[model samples]
Target: MTFESPSASGLTRRGMLTGAAAIGAGSVGLATAPAAAAPLTARGYRTRVVLAGTAGGPPPQDGRLGICTVVLVEDRAYLVDLGPGAVTAYARAGLTMEQVQSVFITHLHSDHLAEVYNLFWLNYGAPGARGNISRSVGIYGPGPAGSVPQAPGAPVQQPEAPTPGLTDFLRGAVAATAYDLNTRMAESRKPDIWNVLDPHDIELPDIGASATNRAPDMEPFEVMDDGFVRVTAILVDHPPVFPSFAYRFDTADGSVVVSGDTAPSDNLVRLARGADLLVHEVYDHAYFATINPRLAETFSRTHTASDRVGQLASAAGVGTLALSHLVPAGVRDVPDQVWKRHARKSFGGTVVVGRDGDTIGIGGRTK
Candidate 1:
């Protein structure tokens, strides 16, 4: 998005730092005391996954593929993805976009990255009341892959293309929005409009973007500070869409993993081993089997089926399974009994079908 001129009442670095400090202190109810210094491992961290856009295709419930948008709340806020409805979901979940410190993209799928531009614009142009923060938000994602685009109906193969890699696409998109961002901010009086700090001031990097340098194996890569908790990503196989990832977050009290969008794979099981929770995408096999044949075919080509998800969760010994990125099946389509029958056959642990605003606490502490 485009950038607006700096605010007339531009906040200085010192003022911004002071404001951040105050917010940090107040959030934890330690505003009046000398900063209680503690190692990252000692301080508790929390995570909230918001189902931004449930429906994937056209609006009015065609299908929901609003890929994952997880919020990692620690000393600072880190967002995992920016699905279509993530902005609204964040607000519904009582989170202000302004407080988000960074955004980590899993892939370049439209459903996954559709909200990136909106998020950037919202933070940089919207009024203050809509969760706009001035802090520079970091954006991270995988780099490009060398591949030729196949014609429609051609046999699908490894390394699909036509869509520039995440790095190139984001760079161009952000660069193009510069003018629009500036114009909107200048026209709006809301505090949200002031949230967009200069894009030049923000750090946007394509982590593991290049195929050669990309960590293709299922190993977790630490993304942020390790003081209170450590966050890492593991490569998972989602073929024809190489370089997909599943992320794990470990805190002192507990650990959690976010299985972005992948078919059942051993990579996920290994990554999730010993985690307290696994937030994974699940598709109802029976429901899809009986629905529109075309849609079912598309589903198979892209995501994991429900039974597979159950098996993966079971094998990993995950403590809890929070099913997200649900398919078109509504309550009637996949009744409780059907879900229980399939899920219980594999995962004996607690299995929750996540809703838009559902909150599952990883550690035993209340935030």
Candidate 2:
């Protein structure tokens, strides 16, 4: 028997080009763009969401990327997660790669951060289409505490402590590019990327640390407030992957929440309450069993179930519910129609089945 790679979700470079054309002059993606929202005039900027990559994973497959989203606040693009196909989708969304000033990681999962350095590497070029970002780029994530789990019941044989936190991860990223950083500064007369990277390790407030079932919640707090927009992150449970987060962006236009990757989390519901849009991760509950049961089972515990996502949306009272980070979005049997129905069952509000390259404007309440 032979296997074949799945298609790229009916999206292509040409399609991206066309989609970008619609965004020309800072207009929204399609005619359905909200009316009351502020245009990208010199004074104010509206908030829009671009689901750069939508697949959550064991490893990116079926032409789906890991998980990434770009929140556009006026001219600025704030990226969340750095999944595999993120860069491509960023370009597809008509966003300049170099202008990406901040990247917020929900957690330290490989699939979520695999492509960050790739973006930073390009962001540091010698001033051209290859990213000429002038100011420092800020990288933020949870403070020290191994995101991984410890060996069980081995008091004397406990393993060495896990990587400290985002700060240590930042070190690893620099080390991975040490040769390039040194060679560029020493040989090419180019500025080193380290000079422009500002890494901040955020400590969650016990304020939101909902400590349910023994795992400490990641309590919410404002991580970035650059005047144009304020980004807040709340801790959600995705165990053994302690300190997982879900973010909310309150901009001039409206409020938008990105539910990283979590099971049924009260914190997420609380943060997303009354939000204009809720972009939540959802798996096809019916089809999850069809995939590898071991992985499916583990993911089922950590990832949100489809129907519950709908319930969460309803509970949050978000104007719009957009589902992404699909667990098996590409499984032939689990077409979007089948999966959407799962969420729709409980959600009466607007529901959109997310796709890579999909741009959702965050202007006003939907319902």
Best lDDT among the predictions, by candidate number:
2
User: What local lDDT does model 2 show for residue 3?
Assistant: 8
lDDT of 2 by residue, 1-367 (tens): 0001112343346444544564322322211112222221111225667776788874756745667888877668899888876666565444675558688988877878777767777666576443466568888876655434546773532246554567677787889788888888788787767777787887766553422442353445788898887999887878766567889998877888998888888889888988988989987666657757777687778888887788999988888788888877563546767667888898887666666656666664323
So what's the TM-score on candidate 2? 0.81
Q: Give the C-alpha miss distance for residue 219 in model 2, angstroms.
A: 6.1
For model 2, what is the C-alpha lDDT against the true structure? 0.69
After superposition, candidate 2 runs with Cα above 4 Å error: 1-45, 128-130, 146-148, 152-161, 207-219, 331-333, 364-367
Best by TM-score: 2
Least accurate stretch of 10 residues (summed lDDT) in model 2?
Answer: 1-10
Question: CA lDDT of each candidate?
Answer: 0.56, 0.69
The residue pairs found clashing in candidate 2 are: 208-219, 209-219, 218-235
Q: Estimate each model's TM-score.
A: 0.72, 0.81
Candidate 1 worst ten-residue window by lDDT: 26-35
Total clashing pairs in model 1: 30
